[model samples]
Target: MKRRNFIYLTGVGAAAAMLPAIPVFGKEISPEQALEHIDPAAKKIMSDVALNAARSKGATYTDVRIGRYLNQYVVTREDKVENIVNTESYGIGIRVISNGSWGFAATDKLDKDSIAKAAELAVTIAKENARLLREPVKLAPQKGYGEVSWKAPIEKNTFEVPVKEKVDLLLAVNDAALKGGADYINSILFAVNEQKYFASTDGSYIDQDIHRIWPTFFITKIDKESGKFETRNALSAPTGKGYEYLNARPEDKIQTASGTLYKGRYDMLEDAKQAARQVGEKMKAKSVEPGKYDLVLDPSHLWLTIHESCGHPTELDRVLGYEANYAGTSFLTLDKWESKKFNYGSKEVNITADKTEVGSLGAVGYDDEGVKCGKWDIIKDGILVNYQAIRDQAHILGLNASQGCCYADNWSSVQFQRMANISLQPGKVKLSIADQIKNVEKGIYIVGDGSFSIDQQRYNFQFGGQLYYEIKAGKIVGMLKDVAYQANTQEFWNSCVAICDQSDYRLGGSFFDGKGQPGQVSAVSHGSATTRFNKVNVINTARKI
Candidate 1:
């Protein structure tokens, strides 16, 4: 339920009003402060206390996580800065398996006495919950890797940048949108840093520091005569990098008449200007005719589709009905995967789940449960080959090792299975975006994510985008307005006619992908080249409110 508004920000002033009643969650460290509260010295001492307590409580298994999460957001609309927020959340989450049942508890107190108590309580809860269990949890064998550490390869710490610098950049982006013809503009910059430490009875201690950034804006244009309005969003991607992601490196730039799209780097001002101009065209563009048309999807537009239709559906927990109360159960079921012949898509579609991609938002050295992360195929050459699974879910798939896709959004939440960076592999041969467009005789080209809706099962869906262009006889003519594409998940992916080669690959992502009962959010990226889907259903959505 995240909206593009500054009203949701409770940082500094009102944040305390939102926190659940709990003991000291962690040290209150500002964004400008060092990430020292969860240092190895403190983590080791604290972890040892919890581990010893759990083992003494007759628990067969236990794991603990100490975390410090920091976030800063700069938001602006039109000519003024709407809000600038800096906030932090820190806590410890403890999980234990007793009587072959899992139980979890979390507390903000970082002291040995508090953490040990939490651990013992978790074991007691696990024992109690085991009473009605029909089947005991079967965990796949895991090896303890002793102590290990990993850090995001960021050139600069976004938190280290001055607040004024970020505010000025966003204001400039809004100004560019206004000058470029947008009647209204709203821009935002989101930055996050997660300092996490995990320890378990498996004899492993893991430490990881991760960072992510996203710069986005919305520009609107109004047609005075008809009083109709249109909006376009910035095509910049959210990446697992630092402020350097916005540095606008020449190598990361992709130029076109529609404007510039970024890969590894982003130019906020240039994109805002592009969105402004695009929105104006959309206001003047012809309304689309309801019909079947080929859709040439840029990564910016296709990522959300992949994230929803592919990533969510393939989650093992969703398929097993564990998340049915929150996110609906998956259409992809055991019957589909056990057959090993389920065609999830066309041969051009090779969706893989990865946590090791260097620049991906989901990239992590290890999952919260201390399982080492790696890459695996979800849909290999159109076949439903594998599904994302954690240690507890791996035995169900007849696998001996976890997929290492487990995660917790914050320190206070228990670790659970989450989606990895699921993406479409590019074509084997060399292909360009231009050449792919030339092959489409009558189609639509869509860029940037917009309004979208999918069914509870992640099957049927309708998606809209920021920019739309009509392709006629192998060329892009003028822009089109009031356009959206609807399709079934399997039908859409199976319609993938061709995929552009690696040179055209790029990324698009979301800063807040929501799931779970209490509703935790995680950031993730999807990568693909220019992909073509034949004869997708397109509809016009131009009704006035």
Candidate 2:
């Protein structure tokens, strides 16, 4: 069979072979098969060698992580195409605990001498810092496991796909948008990742494989008469999948000599054209009068709202003050979780932190610490219920097990608690976006993701979107520009009047979600339905100064 054919067949075959092993409804590999990929003997040897060296040097505890990563990036700007870039990196990092201080070092060379030297340097640094320690460090309790591994579900390997084909496809999308009336179009659809993780300590060992892809496109409309420009973008959420995801996009096409085949490409082009038209209309749009007004937010806009307010504030690290220096702490302190009746929204508001959602950027079978991923609630019935927790943080809060939120961006970085798929549960009623708009006597319909800003506390914020339509007397009049909505976290959630049903819910996320003192970037997703907020304060962008 051809390489592509073999890849496709392997995917199908793996799904069948591992079906019985996976506990989930949809999974491609069994947990055991996933775990078997790691060599237990190698892990044991590495652990013994590293830990013994640390102990001999008078270190208290030690751990090592060996990792390999494969990356590919392809970008296209209008007719200009760039060559696909591929890179491979592998390294091992050693961490040592000595005299109540922690020290770390990493090296790409995996030779025995190099590993030993790295270990020596880590211990030496720990000793040097010991004198500055004010207190002895004590870690939260965790039972050591012998061996473990996890594999994220994927249908194809993005690395196997040709760079020329990827660039061609992206340029085609740009060409289509330009032909559809965009004055200037810039777009990129690229998938760049393959991760191999290995961790070991005095007793525990873990191995994991992760895959990711980020695909995006943007179209801008420029009006020379007014010197004004507006832009719109596709809501293609990054995912923990392969090139198959690009193929699965709602808009994909190829041309043949016979005749023009629709192949769903027309719909994508139509969306782009409509977006451009909206931007053009907005060039002459009047500013929204600053005041409280009933607002209906589309899913494209609502996802980011959820991310800023609910997602960041609910991270246990943020609530506990660990993320204060980088992003500041949250108002939702650990003490207020169970007792606080946070008025997040009406009774319809429900949110969950899950790592199991398919296509989610944060989805994984097991976290970096070898803890199995699972789901939990962040908000229930408009009340603060729980916060995302990793093993150490969970133990600190008197919990027995982790919520599986532990993750490290790279093998060289220390594992920290990170966000998962923080999704807003859809409403019970099957209300459509149009239905929500019809009920509104006067409001604005917001669409697509755009620029946004929020205070450190995740409270006071302003959000802008790709396009806005003016609605009067239960009807969309036309597009509007220079518009933004501002509100406090509590006030905004309290203002939510209604939310659309499951059909309107969609996934959205960021590739570089920063957190921690040293700053680690983790990918996460936010799923939301079209939701309405009452009496939100809208402002004119030009009038802000």
Q: Which candidate is the best by TM-score?
A: 1
List per-prediction Cα lDDT, in the order shown.
0.85, 0.68
Per-prediction TM-score: 0.94, 0.83
Evaluated against the true structure, the overall lDDT of model 2 is 0.68
* Top candidate (lDDT): 1
CA shift of 435, model 2, Å: 2.6
In model 2, pairs of residues that clash are: none
lDDT of 2 by residue, 1-545 (tens): 01011111111211122111101111133222222343546645665666677778878877777765554555555687633444444567677889888787877666677778888888999988888998765555555666766667777776666666777777777787777666665555545453444444535676666777866656666777865566666655667777776664443432211111122112333444555555556666777766666788765567788988999999888888888888888988766765677666667788999998877888876676656678898889888888988855676566787888877766566677888889888888998777888888878888767779999989899998867777788888776777799998878887877888876667777776877766667788888877888888998887443
Q: Give the TM-score of candidate 2.
A: 0.83
lDDT of 1 by residue, 1-545 (tens): 11111235321222122211111222344555644455687787888899899889988998989887777777777788876666667778889999999988888878788998999999999999999889998998999988889999999999889888998998889888888888777777888888999999998889899999988776667777876677777788889999998888888887754567887888888888777777777877898988999999989999999999999999999999999998999999999999999999998889999998987899899999999999999998899999999999999999999999999988777789999999999999888778878898999999888789999899999999978889999899989988899999999999998998988888788777888977677889999998999999999988856
> What is the number of residue pairs that collide in model 2?
0
Q: What is the lDDT of residue 431 in candidate 1?
A: 80
